[model samples]
Target: MTAFMEPFRIKSVEPIAFPTAAERRAALEAAGYNLFKIDADQITIDLLTDSGTGAMSAAQWSALLSGDESYAGARSFRRFESVVRDLTGFAEVLPVHQGRAAERLVLSALLKPGQASVSNTHFDTTRAHVELAGGKAVDLPAPDGGNIDLVRLRASFATEDVACVVLTVTNNGLGGKPVLMENIRATRAICDEFGVPLTLDAARFAENAYLITELEPEFTGHSPRKVAELMFRSADIIWASLKKDGIANIGGLVALNDPDLAARCRLELIAYEGFPTYGGLAGRDLDALAQGLLEVTEPSYLRYRAESARWFGEALRAVGMPVVEPVGLHAVYIDAGELLPGRNLPANALLAELYLEGGIRASELGTLAFGRVDPAGGPDIPSARELVRFCLPRRVYTRSHLEYVVEAAAAVVKRAEAIPGYRIVHQDPVMRHFTARLAPML
Candidate 1:
C-alpha cells in the first residue's frame, strides 16, 4: 500500500453465511445478535459498540481491578481526571456509566420545568431525557438539521428559561454529519451572551475531533487534541461515552466547572447507580477505557477506521446503492430511497429484511434512529425512512471483513429491492419502521 492508501479492502475476504435457521439460531445464541455474524477471513468487523476492547495496558488494568474503594480510589479517579484534562483540557471530571447515564445525570442537575435546552442537534437519548425532566429540547434552528445554527440558538438563549445548550459532535441523526468549527465557536459566543452553559454530547467526540483536524486538513493546524480542548473550553459541563471516546465496553464521564452541579449529579448516582467510585463499570473496564482514549488520538488509528468506512461505501456506491457520503469514523448508511421509490418499503421493514438475509443487523431513520417517537395527529415532521445502518466496531475487523460486508449488503439490496410491500415488523415495541398496516401514503 502507498503511504496515503490503506492496505484494507473488503473484497479480499469471504462473508460468513449460515445454511439454515438452526445454525443461525446457534450463532445468535453464542454471540448474542451482535455484528459478529459479519465475518471476514479471520475476524468479524464489529462496528456495534464504540468501546474498543483489548486496548488497555497491563498496568492500567491492574489499577482499575484493584477494587479498593478509598479516597485513594481517588487515584483511579484522578488518573481518569488527568486523562480528561489532557485530552479535553477541562478542569473537572465525574465518572458515569454509559452515555445516556451521563445525559440523564447532567439534565437532572440542570433542567427544571419550562427550561429550554438549545442544541445544534440531539441524539434520541439526549432529547428524551431533557423532555422527561420537563425541559423543552430546542433543535436550535440549524440551516439544516445536519448543521448547527448559531444565530437562532443565540436568540433562543434570550429566554430566562434556557438552561443549557448541547452540541452533538458528528450529528448522529443526519448520518453522523458534523457541525462546522466556526459554528461551534459561534455557539460558544451565544452561550456566553446568555450565560447558559454549553454541554457537549461527546459520544462521538474522538471521531469528530479526528475528522475536523486530519481528514479535512483545511483545518489541520489544530490537532484532535487541540479541537477537543477548544470544544471543552466552551462548555460548563462536558460529558462523553467512554464506549465511543475510550473504546471501552460501557462507561462514560461527565465533567463540569460547577462544584454544586457535580455534587447534585453524584447524589443522583447514589440513588440510581450505586456509588461514584464504581458507576456500573468494572475496574478493568476503566483501565480499558483509559487505554482506548489514548489510542483514539493517533492519526493512524483514526485513518484506519475512516478508510475502512470509505472503502465499503465506495463498493456500495459502485454497485449503484445509495449510501450516506462518508463523513465520520464509524458506520456507513445505505440510503433505501435510491432502491425503492421514495423509500417505499419504510425503514422498519427494510431493517427486518436485511436481518433475514445472510446479514443479521441494521436500522432505519424514522423509527429505529430515535428508538422513541410520539407522533402528533396533526401535520407531521418529515417521515424520512432514511437508510439501513451498518455500524463498524473499531479494531475488530480488517480489509477482508469489510469486503464481505459490502458484498453481502450489495446482494441483499439487489434482492430486497425487487420485492414490494413486505411488512416491517417492530419487535422491540419501541422503534417501528414500516408496517403493512400503515397506509402507503402515510
Candidate 2:
C-alpha cells in the first residue's frame, strides 16, 4: 500500500487537555458513563463524532470574509446554490442548519400518516424524524454489504405504502460501507418501476465517490467529482450534512428536481428553519460551506481522508480487536459484542473502558443507539450488532494522535476480560444513547 500524507499543512492549532487518571474517573462518573455527556475539555483525543468538528481550510476562511450578510437573497446563498446545483443537477435547492433539519423538512412534506420510509439502514436521526412525521422507518440491509436488499425493497413496494426510498451512500449506520454504483443503478431502476421517488442521504458523497474510483472497474481512472456527479444523477432527491464531506464546521442542504415537493418543504423551512435563502444559517456559514464543498472533492484530500481511517482500522485489527472489515472513510467501527462475548451492553462497556484507559472518547453505534424497548416489560430487543465508532473529524488530528488511540486500544485489549459490562438505568424514549445513564454490571 502506498503511504498517503496530509495534503495540506495545519495553519491553526488548539490545545488539548491531558486530564489525570483520577480526573478522568471523576469525569466519567459525573457524565453517567455517557461519552456524549463528557466535556470536551476532559478529552485528550476526541473521536466521539465527525459531525461539525472538522478543521476549515484557509480558502474557507477567506470565503467567510466575502459573505454577503443579507437576510434574503444573499450572494453567499447564491454561491452555495450554484455549487450544489452544479454537483447535484437539482433545480430546487433548500438550505438548512444541518442534515436533520433537512430530513425533517423533506420527510414532513412527503410522508403521510401510516406510510413507510425505507432505507438500507436509517441513521438514528433520520429514523426519528420519520416516526415524528407519523410514518414508519424500515431498513432492508443487504446480507454482504451496505447495499439495500433489492429483492426486499422491490417487494416492500408491493406490500407497504412506502413514502420514499432513501439510499445512504457510504451507509453510516452499518459500518460506513460504500454502496456499489451498480446497486445505486439497480435501486433507481426499481424506484422507477414502482413510481416511487429515491433520495440519497449523501453525507459522505465525496468519500463514497473516491471509493468507487478505487473499487469499481467501470469508474477506474475517473475523477472523484465526475464519479460524484454520476452518483447524483441516479437520485430524485439528495440531502447532506455538509459538516462531514463539505469540510465545514456547520451547514447542510436538500436538493431535488420536484417543484411541488420543494415548495412544500420550503413552507416547512420558513415555519421552522428560516427564509428560503438563509435557512437558519448566517451568510458567512453559507460562504464557508460553498468553499468547503469545492475543496472536499479534490482527489488528494479524499485519498488522505480514506487512507488514514483505513490505516487506523488495520492497526487496531492487527492487535486482536475485531474491527469492522473494509473501514469506511470517516470512522473505524469495532465489534464490541465480539470483543466482550456474553457481556451485557458490551458496546457501552467498551466505551467507558476506552475513556478510562485514555482520555479518548468514542461513540457507541449498537444496541443503545438502535435497539427498541419492549413496552410490555419483556426482554429488550437488541441491535443487529454492537459497535463502537471512532469517528475521525475531517482535516483534524495528526497520525501521532491516532497512534495514541492505538496505544489506548491495545491497552484495553490486554485487559479485555476484566472490562465490566453496563446496564442503562435511565434513557430517553428516542435517541437514548445521547443522554442515557448507565451503571457497571459488576
Candidate 3:
C-alpha cells in the first residue's frame, strides 16, 4: 500500500473525570509520597498556548476572521506572506494545513532515493515523511544539553548525500531545549558550503524565541521577535505548525527564500490539499492563526507560559522525581527510569499506568519514536523503543489541572512499587504496553 493508505489500528481509552478534589487528594495521600507529578493549581498561571483560547484582542480577532475577499483567496497567500515577512522577513510563503503537512510537502519535493536529511533531533512525523519519500533520516549526535551536536552535523553534511538539513528551533524530542544561537550560525555556514537547503521545523518557534530572551541571561534585552529573525537567517525554508505557535486551531505554512523552491512545493500541495488559496484552513482559523502569531510576541504572553512551566517543574522536583532538568515550553517528562527502582518498567508502561489511573493522556516516546530507512534496495519503515511523554498543551489547562496530574501520578508510582516485578509486554514493537503479570521488583 502507498504511505497514505496505510491503516493504523486504534486503541481507545475512555476518559473519566475524578469525583472530587478531595478524592484526588486522598489518592495522593494514600500513595505515601507526592514526588513526580505536577502541582495542578499552578498549571493555568500565564497560559499562552495557541490552543484557540489564549487572550487575543478584539481587533486581532476581527483581522483574522473577516473573510473579506481581500484577505481570503490569492490575497490570502499575501495574508500568510505578509505575516511571514513581518515576523521573520522571509521572502516567500505557502500555506498548508499544519506542521506535519508542511513536512510531507518539503520532504516529498526535495528528497530522492539514496538521499538523506539530517537534524539534531526530529519530530516523529517529520522523520516519517523523510523515510516515506525514499530518503534517510539522519540525526546529529546528542549534545550534553540534549540538544543537537552541531559539530557532528557539520561533518555529516560534508560526506553524506544530504538533500536538506532540518533544525527544529526547540528540540521538542529533548524536553523542548532551545538550540543555541551559535549553532544556528555554524549550521548555516555548513549548508551554504554544500549547496544544501536548510529547512526549519518551527512548530514551537515562539516558545523557543521566548526562552532565548527570558531564560538566557546572556540574551537579555533581546526580543522574541528579534530571536525569530536571527534564527530564520539560517533557513532557506521555514515550516511552522500554526496550531502550536499560532492561534491554536489547525493550519500550517512553509516560507522560503527561493521562489522556484516555493513554487515547486506549492505544486505538490495542490494534489494533497487544495489550491494555493485555501490549503486546508477554514476562513476563521486563518484569521486566528494570524492573530496568534502576533500574540506570541507580547511580553505578557511569554511570561505566563514560562512562569507556569517553572512552577510545575519546582513542584515535581520537591517530591523527589526526576523532571527534565530545566523545563522547556509546553510539555514535561518524568524520568520513569528513576521513578520505578529495580523494576525495569519501560516508559511505555508508565504511560499506560498514567492512563489507567485517571484517564490522563500521555505518549510512549520509546514505542512511538518512528522513522523510516532504506537499506541498499529495500523499503523504509519505523524503528521501535520505549519511553513516555507528558504533553501539557497550553490554554486548555489550569493550575488545578496540573496539581491533579502531580497528585495522581504520585499515587500511581506508590502503587507500582508494591508490585514485585511489573513489566511492559511487547505485544507490538511499534506500540508496547504493560501486561497483567505483576511481581515485586528486587
Against the true structure, candidate 3 has what lDDT?
Answer: 0.64
What is candidate 3's lDDT per residue for 133-171, written digit by digit as tens? 988888773654435677787778657899998888777
Highest-lDDT candidate: 2
lDDT of 3 at 361: 51
Give a tens-digit lDDT track for model 2, residues 1-442: 5778999998999999999999999999999999899889999999988999999999999999999999999999999999999998999999999999999988988899999999999999999999999999999999855889999999998888998999998899889998889999999999999888999999999998998999899999999999999999899999999989888888899999999999999999999889999999999999999999899899989889888998999999988789998898999999999999999889999989889989999999888999988989887799999999999999899899999999999999999999888998899998899999999988
| Per-structure clash totals for the candidates | 12, 0, 26
Please give, for residues 1-442, the per-residue lDDT of candidate 1 as tens digits.
6444443333333354444555544444343232233342212333333444323334445556754444336455656667777877766566777888899999978899999887876766787788889888877546444457866766675564799888888777667766666667777777787787878888777678777785455577766766767767766788877776676667898887788888888888777865676676655555556666776776766777787777777887786677777545677777665566544445544544444454445545554444333465442334444556666765556567667666666676777645443322223332233221332223
Best by TM-score: 2
* Deviation from native of the Cα of residue 49 in model 2, angstroms: 0.9
In model 3, the worst 10-residue window by lDDT is: 1-10
Please state every model's RMSD to the true fold in angstroms.
5.3, 1.0, 10.0
lDDT, each prediction: 0.64, 0.92, 0.64
Q: TM-score-based ranking, best first?
A: 2, 1, 3
Ranking by lDDT: 2, 3, 1
Candidate 3 Cα misplacement greater than 4 A, ranges? 1-65, 69-77, 215-218, 341-345, 370-387, 419-442
